[model samples]
Target: MSEKEAETPGKRTRPGPRKVTPKYLENAALFYLQRFATSAANLRRVLMRKVERSARFHGTDPAEGAQWVDALIARFVASQLLDDALYAESRAQSLRRRGASGRTIALSLRQKGVEGEIIDTAMAAADEAEEKPELAAAARLARKRRLGPWRAAEGRREARERDLAALARAGFSYDVALAVIDAEGPADLEGEGSL
Candidate 1:
């Protein structure tokens, strides 16, 4: 390309590169943790993604960048700043309160890099405490979305299929979805069922 074409009249150039030193990575890690709770692997993935972007724009070696990422992750883990088990437990509780089914909570935690065993343990704890974890979550979802028992009587009949589909997409089992959809009122869905 000619110099004239390269120097476009109104195009914006990419920003200058930031150095990816250990101190820089540490500061980045601190900032990330302050803003969000994360699993060890999730934190590593976030830091490595930044490193990859930095390497790509600055023309640095990827292997070196990866090493830096690993070192920072190890430091964080050693300091107890990155704990997957804690993250999974906290995340599971939050999801449950927000009307997420056990299946949905597990999937969400797994996607965030939590181990399956940790997810299972956290959910098991929830189940032990709640009469029916899935039922409770489905009830909360119905109330929040104004589906089933929470819906206006005039609209309930028409919205049945759509409400069931919504529950299904949210990871509720067939029986759970049906229970939520068929509830006469929010109180009706408070207990466990044969399904």
Candidate 2:
């Protein structure tokens, strides 16, 4: 082996990330927004992480990066490119469709840095969009996990308590869990037009 190649370790050291600038932060934010719906705070968090990484590797000032992030976020919000209310509502609906209870959806939105008021509004919207939203969500969960009515006849009776527990753990109330778990069949859940 050549002395230059042999002198190096088996693994090559990758270059550090580029120093964060306003333009770089803007580009990163735009790219992120293009792929995922996010609240202003969540987007800020993502961009700040990039800033922090660059600061650690390139000795850049995080405070400067933070200022850039703040300005970029403000600009996006002003342009209506970042709408927390819309994000929360859309996310709540999507989560509900995937069997997430209202409580679960609220918690998820909170973790994403959405305000409580906005989460409440979003949840109300979700509720208005469906009758007995919790029950519907529970039903969807049961169907997806093959619990309760979706289970085979032979084992359903034996797994009754387990099915209820699963729904309970998924942020469903006891009443909702029982209703879904004790359902006679998938058709029973659809009686309320919730399915």
Candidate closest to the true structure, highest lDDT: 2
Q: Would you give me the overall lDDT of model 2? A: 0.92
Q: Candidate 1 lDDT, tens digit per residue, 1-195?
A: 558758896776656768687788889989999999999888888888878887887887778878988988888888999988888888888888889988899889988988888999888876666778888888888888888999999999999999999999999998989988997877777665222
lDDT of 2 by residue, 143-174 (tens): 99999999999999999999999999999999
What lDDT does the true structure give each of the candidates? 0.84, 0.92
Whole-model lDDT, candidate 1? 0.84
True lDDT of residue 48, candidate 2: 95
What are the clashing pairs of model 1?
Answer: none
Error of 1 at 136 (Å): 0.3
Worst 10 residues of 1 by lDDT: 186-195
Q: What local lDDT score does residue 23 receive in model 2, on the 0 to 100 scale?
A: 91
